[model samples]
Target: MAGARVDPPVHGDPATLGGYELIGRLASGGMGRIYLARSAEGQLVAVKTLLAEGVVSDVERRRFAREVELAQRIDSAFTARVRDADPQAELPWMAIDYIAAPPLSELVRTAGVLPASAVQWLAAGTAEALVTLHGEGIIHRDLKPQNILLPLPGPRVIDFGISHANDLTRTSLTLGTIAFTSPEQARGEPSTEASDVYSLGATLFHLALGRPPYRADSDTLGLLAQVQRGQLDLDGLPKELTALIRPCLAVDPGRRPVPAEMLARFRQSLAGLPVSQGGRRWLPQRWTDLIGAYERHGRDLARGAGIGAGATAEGITVDQRTGMVPPPEPTRVYTQERERAERERAERERAERERAERERAERERAEKERVERERALLAQERLREREWQQELERRKAENKDRERAEEKARERAARARARQHASGPSSASAGAASGTSRPSSRPDPARTPPPAPAPSKASSAVVWLVALAVAALLVLWLATWV
Candidate 1:
């Protein structure tokens, strides 16, 4: 492949596209320009924008958006990988990996024509890329040498599915594009997968013979006519390369080999060649040297631009190959979001703590209430015990009082019995004495003087009765005292 055609930024270019810093211009066309830009991570990317010169209409924006969609669908290593895009941007743009290889057009110009083996290798690589592109139902309407880049690994197809829908409408189908235009595209017919095959054949023809299939020095109308008629000069092509490439240049799109078939044919033809052990041995040494120079130049440009030279805040190292820096670990927006989440978590924890504290306090309060209730019960029990003891003491005192009253009554009864017995005996003795005296005074019964002796006896009896009365009174007083 040829060296990259990197140009310095002009006045019309923007400083940045889709947040990528535009360091240089890669290429430009009627619709827009492809800029060599650096990402936030310092990785080099080619950013294509829709703002060419005039006010970008809605139709143009939609077309550019479609281009981004088509480009994104291609996931093969043989194609430029899309990095980022913003179809809704004011100036809609798409970013792709900045391949550090030159186009086959420039390569052929600088290093002269490639040998048969090298050409076959180029054809095989491009055919494989076409297989991938066609598999996605995409036809590279503008497949030309300028769109094919040859890096170390393999050939990379760039600028696929751009603004080809408007190709026929636009009046700026330049000489560079018309040579590779398929007969169907030249005749204003819808270009199909087979159209891409025709274009590939024309492109390979250029690589081999160092000129387009059709002479470009002719007028535009005549060139279009020649392409429409499939009038090509393949006279100077090598005998071995002719059989494989000649069928591709057939006027009928049906006769042209499919990309897969073309890939198989090329691989089979170059099967006897020595295997390229991870180097660009399929290319001449001079071409390989140019590829190295281009790679070194890209590295130097990255260093000079100071792209992704330091570690990210996340401590992830920058990519050494592309000088690509990863996204910042904590952007301002992300930091704010994180802080909000942290605050929420802290609030939740605080609520949980408060709930736990409330539960603990409630338990403590319940425990205290239980203790107080037990104490009150105990106090009531003690008061009941005291009342019972008082009642028992009062009962004991009443029993003693009853017992003393009974004893006093018994003593009083005994005293009264003894007094009665004593009085009876005294009365009986007096009567006996009176009886003896009466017998002696019986002789003088008739006499009046016998009354005097009886008077003494009566007096004695009266005294005895008085004494018994006094004793009975004393006994009553003693019973009262007791």
Candidate 2:
């Protein structure tokens, strides 16, 4: 909740802490002051002196002492080993291995991300240190870009001032820079092995993206969001190491690959095996020679193309050409006049071609429009003829029905007369015995045929035909225009 406190630098007279002779101030921070001091045996060491005036409580002093003892126990080559410490002194000071290399941040700022080989070395060394620290049951509460020092052979992890062991929970408040704190630490939760993994992921993100994944106005909120939802954008990352980095940045702590496993994967990736085949593989010995050959080839091509050869001031000519640079010639009045005329002629030709293209496009668009209109007219005419035919068929059906009804009526009357005559003659015989009566003959009736309609729906038909003829004419006209 408080703003970053700017602690004034302690400018006391130079004094020795333990056996190391204090020299001068190297750097200072809220918790302590680092001095460039010499060991009694003449070895240079960086001594971090913690202010004791503020440590009034006995518990705070004991916690500070415990931190010093924990730091002194770590003896890994990948880490800066503490040589000596005097926790009970008026100003507690601890001496650590003074490395002679720039911080990882500085190296990246000056020179870009370490080349593939350098990154591999860094991973191997850092992973080794992490394994050692975690094995000692210590969580390196702060592991970020600035804490990793780049030594000649490899990188060394430093700054274990706020580190604590598995059982120690002295510092209730977050101690490290907010940008690199793991999600758990940022939320004031006790840190674990997974927390260290999260910090490592943040560190790798910086290395890969050339910036922290979470950088907002509020460092605390940004870090929390990164811990919750951040995913490394590895789209353009070199293929060789993306596989190794993706798992390290897994949001789930259990999903994150262990440091040792990551190191092995990194080694396997570098071996140019199936897992590493996607990335480029080049021998260190041949890289420089290949680059030189490429540069020379480029220079020769440039020379052939009548371009200037680029070189450096060290007398190292990238191009094989060796001669005094010549001054450019001035154009003559007649030559200028000829160039001007040629340019004008070319411009005129270009303008004519463009105008012709525009006219052709316009004509084609108009022709297409005409064709579409003709197709629409043809469709409309076909629909009209179908409707007229349906109407005529319905009228014919009605006329045929009337003719059938009239014929049926005439046949029924003739059959009734015949039946009456037969019944009178057979009446006696039919009454005497159960004899069968003579059957009546059926009448032969001719059904009248329906007459044809006086006129066809010539109006609709004629209109349809006219439309078809018109469309055909329009198509013909379009072709002629073309």
Candidate 3:
């Protein structure tokens, strides 16, 4: 049946599948197609259908069956529960509990990477799922953001089609989305628990940065190459999460922390955290009130001081032309002191602001320097990688040439031997007598050849010679100056 454009296709007319009523297609993938189905008992279940043509080979069919059976065995609150399966059937299919929730990809697309609280919740939920999967010795090889469903209670990990059970070498399934694949996976290694962790790190990186860690023009290979070499920019990420994700995305799988351990650490990092721990609290009302009060108080203070400067304490008006009654000594002293304090405070504030500005400038300068350094390092790494690839290509070409030359030499040697044998046989047939060989004196051993300097050695000698000549010239100039 043709599936709808909408993700997790809506329910439709009933079509029977192994006595169960097929309602509609939920999702379609390369491995199989999922359909919303209802059983005889009227319980809704998701049925996955494997195409006959798709599983033409026995190995492919067995692999499909194993996936279904394995998925059925695993059960977790954070994971979609597999209800039943018929692996041996002509058209293999598996049924799982129907979960009603939008995938994380859709949610994030609709409402940008969720608020910090939501992100924390997402992390916690996914961590729990990982813990369950790890305990069962199962690695969800394809742990992309889309596979994670955001339900009302929490996040639920779905689509275990590419999951490996216990023995990593048992399956050769090329699992995982390109953008989220770990370095090892890119290098053609099987996905391990650490691979899942790397994927989580990639997802989190996307959540924080609003983009993947690596940006590339081409497909998976380009992203894989970037992943193999790219460094995460922690400046754009929250300082707390940066440390956690760094090890998760480490190029070496052995370096990443276990799922449970990572979860525990993340929880510990977030436990009892104040709203202002990261930065300014999001208190719009309080901010508005403070601003309003400051403006009102400043205006009132200015007006009062202005009026008091000209008016007498006894309600009598003072004249400026004639020497009028001067303002009270106490008031004048207070005003002068207040003005002086105000000026001092303003100066202090200005100095503080200047210092902050200078510090910010220094930070910008340092940041620029760091970026340049990182860019240089990345460039150097790329250059080295390119050089290594080129060297390999050259070596391969040289080996091919050497092989051809050896084959030609061998053929020529064989022809020469045959010619010599034919000539000796013909001579024997002609009754030619053998001649006695005369012993010749061996030539004197050649004189020991001088060792040639290496390129590096030659360059060094040239440099040293130039330096010595320069020193001599300087010495001559010094003597002339003297």
Candidate 4:
């Protein structure tokens, strides 16, 4: 309805909130600024971020987080739906439906006062919104016209700035806009359902007559004092609305009627009107046409621009409009942690390399031992061959000695045979003379023991056998040493 309160982003403004790209400034207030953003899926949303300065205390943060919970609990068609929020974010923020509707303030300020039938429609919708909100144990402490949106479907109550549970007596905040504020809130008392009701009455009065019920001067203190006085000035208001809206502005909180009762009263007051004859075609003709044109234009714009149409984003783009987000945070970081992880990885690789080297060294040592054993075996074989050659040589030497001894024995035997033959046959005289001459020169051979030569041969053979045995024993000892 009213054009976006669009402004260029200033220096030091975050390019994105959580993840939604902040395209334009909607409106800035004491709490924070609202931004127009498009989600990844192309839906528009109004992102409200709390002022970093105002978010100093844990007490205030808890209170804000509590209000966020209240906003989430309300799921009514008459109010803007909360899409996302993170109370523990860097700066606390929330994303709500971006209803392309003008505020009641803008509508009234532009078009003066609403007709009685149009006001009934608005009242009915607002009362229904209040009923839904109140049913969920929530009170919209700030229900001024600026917070009320006039969309095609109906009025969508937005901005749960100071909403709280009715059961809680004290709020973290103690003040509100004085003109629309209830007497209790102006007196610094706790907000209640009755307080919200009174604000609704004041909002309705302003919608009906183009001004709030009470005002002395426009100063904050003066307006607050007038609200504390609990006075109403509905001089030229329609006769049907006096009874319904008057009780809502009661001085005592108990005297104010609940939203359901007021909704019934407004319904009864609008019963006789011709516009109320229709089920939902009850809006004035000018407003109906206006709403229709607004919707058609919205559709045409959507079709033309695609999903993310609102942003004329200049710088960095971060689309978080799908409403999905990563995990809030780990019990968690960047350079230092990454470096630590890198160090750990490097250490693991080094350990792996060391283990591989150890295995390689062990294999090499085992191979060396095998080579040494092979060398030892080759040396032992060579020693056995040398010992065999020495044994053969010693056997050949013993054979040669045996052969010479045999020849000497054979010669001695030949001489004995010749003597026996002489003794037995001829040359007895020669034999006797030789014998007498040789007696002094040599000892005479014993002819009876003729096997002495054989005996010597046997001794020679025994010596050869012993020499072979010794060679074999030497070979065995050498093998053992090797």
Candidate number of the best TM-score: 1
Best by lDDT: 1
Give one digit per residue, the lDDT tens place, for model 1 in 276-322: 62337777888788777667766766664323323111111111111
TM-score each candidate: 0.58, 0.51, 0.50, 0.54
Q: In angstroms, give how far residue 212 of model 4 lies from its true place.
A: 1.5
Clash pairs of candidate 1?
Answer: 2-102, 2-107, 3-102, 41-325
Question: Which consecutive 10 residues in model 4 have the weakest lDDT in total?
Answer: 316-325
Per residue, candidate 3 scores C-alpha lDDT tens digits across 1-482 of 01111122346422666767775444454455666566787666667766456335676567767676667666788788777877776677677765544455544444455444445556767878888877777787767666775545556787553334443223222212566778777677777889998988887766665556664232334345666664444456676566667777888889887778866865786668763322113212332233233334323322322122232112111111001112222222112354665576689789999999999999999999999999999999999999999999999999999999999999997896566544544544334344534321221113323235357877999999999999999999999999
Better of 3 and 4 by lDDT: 4
TM-score, predicted candidate 1 vs. hidden true structure: 0.58
Superposed on all Cα atoms, the candidates' RMSDs to the truth, in angstroms, are: 31.2, 26.4, 38.5, 31.3
TM-score of 2: 0.51
lDDT of 1 at 181: 88
Question: Local error of candidate 2 at 449, Å?
Answer: 50
